[model samples]
Target: MYRERPAAVITGAVLWASEAGPDAPPTRVLPDGCLDLLWSSRAGLLVAGPDRRAHLSRSAAGERWRGVRLPPGVGPAVFGVPADELRDRRVPLDALWGRAAATLAERLGPSPTATALAAVAADRLAAGGGPDPLAVRVAALLAAGATITATAAEVGLGPRALHRRSQALFGYGPKTLARILRLRRALALAHGGVGLAEVAVRAGYADQAHLTRDVRDLAGVPPTVLLAR
Candidate 1:
């Protein structure tokens, strides 16, 4: 059977592998069928998988681990987003990877230099689309709206124009981005052995089934499947 080899589920908060060093065996984070965001403090960090079905490798102990894989045609990239904004909504992974990502990702690496990546991340975190007046105002309107039209009106743009900006920078539309944020929230709650039911409640879903479906659609696996690993 096709099974994930070498990879071991270390703990609730982080996925770990038991090799002598962090470089014992590499862990390939095959896209977890979700916008999985991870941060690790290890040497030779072999992480290249984008927000989608990403793969990672770490050669430490005599072991190797290939993380869960994603299905076909996953959209968006979701890395380096703020811890607080994780539950924003169903946004595109790639859309979030602009100048903002450059800053946050800098922190993840061992550059040993004072990089501006964090500052960029800070700007986006505090103002998402804000740094830009139009972007910020529009995003704010979207935030207060119950529908897309309301959000557009608040931002002073037509559907087409808003669509372009969202696609260019955020990878997903405002509503979709919102869903990505929601997924992050669900993921955090579901991190440990939290039941799907609880995850749904904590993430503001209708129920466990809803949560499971939501994750499955984005991550390609049911909630149980994700947490089980």
Candidate 2:
């Protein structure tokens, strides 16, 4: 499948993809309950909510999930991106759920995930309660860190432990997650018209050059290119 979102939250990524191929959008939502699971791949999706608290969820293939509640916030704004971006990226389902919950909360209030979250989190916990739980937990704790280890320790896990769990569940490690998070932050900053050098330092990169590389590595283009997109 290919993505074609025009915009995401200026603070986060809002990837776009098509509704075709082995990779397709998950048909989950509500009228009594407003929710949706948009899959970019088996590993990720854009979980959105109509109101209340928002959050993210993740599990293995065929793994069941329970929706989780988050602090009140807005779900990621995905107005415009492109279908092709979904081709190479596989974001963690947990992260997507979180973004969804947060987004919904911001738009609605502190109860967006009340029913849906209560339903799905148990399934997710039961399915993915292996050794990798630590990684998922750590990633969740990384709310505002620029570096990987800071976030890892905050979650009471060492870098190695975080890395191991990330590998098992996310197919990468804490380092990779942190890197992506930083770049996402940078993208958000750039979208807000922040200077590239400022985005770098605020996001924890040493300089604009480093930020450029990180942006290209994950976004397949430079910060300027993404900004244009």
Ten contiguous residues with the weakest lDDT in model 2: 71-80
Report the number of the highest-TM-score candidate: 2
Worst 10 residues of 1 by lDDT: 69-78
Model 2 ranges off by over 4 Å:
1-137
lDDT scores in order: 0.43, 0.44
lDDT of 1 by residue, 1-229 (tens): 1132221221111222233343344333333213223222333212223243223444444432222221111112113433124322333334556564455446545432112222322343344322335544544454333357777777677989877666544434566654555676677766756767787887677887888777777666676776665
Candidate 2 lDDT over residue span 1-229, tens digit each: 2233322222212223333323333431111111233432332334444221112223334432223322111111121112122222334444545565455445533333223333333334344432233433554555366357676666676878866655543334556556655655777788888988888888888888998887666655677866774
- TM-score of every model? 0.43, 0.46
Q: Scored by Cα lDDT, where does model 1 land?
A: 0.43
lDDT of 1 at 51: 42
Model 1 off-target regions past 4 Å? Answer: 1-110, 113-130, 134-146, 189-195, 198-207
Model 1, position 12: C-alpha lDDT score: 16
Go through the candidates in order and give the C-alpha RMSD of each one to the true structure: 11.2, 13.7
What lDDT score goes with residue 202 in model 2? 86
